[model samples]
Target: MSFDGRLLSGISVLAAVVQSRNFARAADVLGITASGVSRAIGRLEERVGVRLLDRTTRSMVLTDEGRLFYEQVAPLLFGIEEAAVSASGAGGVARGRLRVDIDPYFLRSQLSGRLGGFLRAHPELTLELVTRDHVGDLVTDGIDVAVRFGEPVVASAIARKLMETRVLTVASPGYLKKHGRPVHPSDIAGHHCIQFFDPVTRRPFDWEFHRGRKVLPVATLSRLYVSDVGTMVNECLAGTGIAQVLAIRIQPLLESGRLIDLFPDWSGETFPLYALYPSRNHQPAKVRAFVDFVSKVIREPPAHR
Candidate 1:
């Protein structure tokens, strides 16, 4: 095959594979079968006269040659996209797909209702909100942006601090009424405490508390353990046990008198919530617009009561 033809096919197949991460997913994205994707990749490798990917039944990883090829071509492809956008005057408008990954609990409490205004602001933009507890890779996964808790560990990504999340110990009013509110951190050892299990660490999180210039760790007496923060909040609301959760997650329940804050004077460590992307240099206009909108929302007061 000619160089042009080989390059064209390679770029397409490479992009599909990188975006999807699996032959089946790539096939779905490209409107083809898994066998078709495999065939295309095979042809691409034959044309280039080099193996591009290391594949197994479970996973597909790129070879050194494939990585170099992708690094060189990705920018060119993005440049072409940017040129098209400029020629079409799309840069002046917010349009096209805006893909974002966010924590499920944060999205439910903070972004669910407020997204309407963002959509209204950019009428032409199509938004895809992916709610997952697992951290997503922005580049290979084709995510335009992500709203996540904590600082970005990846050096390649650009992170902007959106807000500081405050953790609180709370329980349903009925639970407190029945079991009595704990006056000290040691008091929690006797109470039924709802624990969030860290999936990566395989350990239940202990409750954190501050005592005037000293931080104290309250070892959780977990009667019920859960992975989902939303479920934990609901369990607390059902009068199951005291839960240590992000303050924003339980704000509605607190305001509605369904839940009461325990150890009101004690505050846990505050962590930064960040908006992250694959760096600012030559960022997509759609991504820039979405990030700016999200930053604005973060700066503003909570829309919910």
Candidate 2:
């Protein structure tokens, strides 16, 4: 007949864990100790008559029943948060937790050095930036927006094309001096090239160069294959091998003379950057603020991207 306030507290703790993905992070968000967070979850599990989280020393995940419970509870939590924001007259402000899924290369090359301004502008928002290779379930992962290159994987979400950056095949001067620059794309066969995998295809992306309307698909050789673009860039810079990278990502290096664009004339190939969000309607202010900040940060002079 009466409301159990403790149940609400437990639900809040559960939501925190789902958003933060660990007891320590959840504890920080809730302003409680890690042990306190664990106790809260224990009490919550006892009350619910099933284990909501399967926890190991290194990681934790929602059980099947836990995920179902979370699915039912998540909408209620969102409603409560919206109502609270409205009641406090901060509904339109970017004042809540903002979880962003970003590409590792974009984070390192573009957003890392520029985020201080955004953080200063939105002091009330807690920004969690997660670097991922693929766009997973946004709601289940608690991701507010995904900033990535290439196309959107899911049809349900909204996708905004931010910019298209040219792809350049580059090598350090040291590597080129030793192996000689490839005048033609086919000459790339003899040189060691850093391979970046296509997360969707589960194989290293086949190297391709474009000049005008001509497309040259090179069967490149690689002694090193990196899973992320940042690492591939580093490997290229280290004289390990030639790498095909987004031009905007390495424009500074090219200008600094640390890495040379093997064929600047072959810069016709381009990759598009996109911001994908869970919904088109009632999008959170935090998501909009972040997406806009990213747009401004990564866009280059028309020549660069």
Candidate 3:
């Protein structure tokens, strides 16, 4: 079949239909009527000489040929769209809404305090920041960028290391005054500890510590358990118990003498921070801007807390 001017439009509509799972939805995305979307797909199918969709009154599914075509064409379409965005307006300013899914703790500790600078730097851009303790499916959630703790696992997205925050054992001055400071990791077992439950694993996270070559998770018992990072911070602030937390989150408190680091020599483990995005090839300018800003902010020690 001879290529024509309508080829790109037809392929785009077909891809959008598959992505939206309905012609009406695809039309909404493409800023056209549902009938127009149907015609675009039909014209493309006629041109290609194969059925692209299995349609019913209520729903439609991709045929084998359509699936193969979509799989090959979707990435190219994404590249084209991104290229247009990159070249649009004067000097190609990054002007768009950035959907960011961030770790709740990281948001509270690092981003919430430093966002003003980023927003001022890119006034044309808007930000939608969603905070969650557990990472969700990025594509399904429509997340443009995700900042998460731990190693990156998503194969489809590019993960950039932002920085590492030390895992620290900390306590309020009042709590330490009352219970006495624990000099060794072993002493933690006898003290009242506030434990944070892992939302994903459904168990209290083990307190990991190290001194020299000896690194281990201290299985200390706790009567208080919290699932949320904010709650854990509050509990520690209230002088209820000693807690293991990310040092960056409690830096201000430590500096202000509201909290004191406990077993400093033993508490040396660091957790990696990562920024994940859909594609390296055609990353939106807005996504690139946000990622760069966040990396800069988190990497600076003074921005934390």
38-150 per-residue lDDT for model 2 (tens digits): 99999999999999999887778888888778867766767777778889988878877788988887788777766888999999988889887788877558788898898
Question: Model 3 over residues 1-305: C-alpha lDDT tens digits?
Answer: 78567989898888677656688888898999999998998999998999989988688888878766765676687787776765765334667667898988778777786788888988998888988777765553457789888787666677888888888898898898888988888888899999888777788877878777889767787899888888988889999998988877788888888888887788668888898875535567788888888777766766343
Error of 3 at 201 (Å): 2.0
Which should have the higher TM-score, number 1 or number 3?
A: 1
TM-score of each predicted structure versus truth: 0.81, 0.76, 0.79
In candidate 2, residue 201 scores what lDDT?
79
Alpha-carbon lDDT, every model: 0.78, 0.84, 0.80
RMSD of 2: 4.3
**What is the full ranking by TM-score, best candidate first?**
1, 3, 2
| Global Cα RMSD, each model | 3.8, 4.3, 4.4
In candidate 1, the residue pairs with backbone N, CA or C atoms under 3 Å apart (3 or more residues apart, or in different chains) clash, namely none
Cα lDDT of candidate 3 equals: 0.80
Question: Considering summed lDDT, which 10 consecutive residues are worst modelled in model 3?
Answer: 85-94
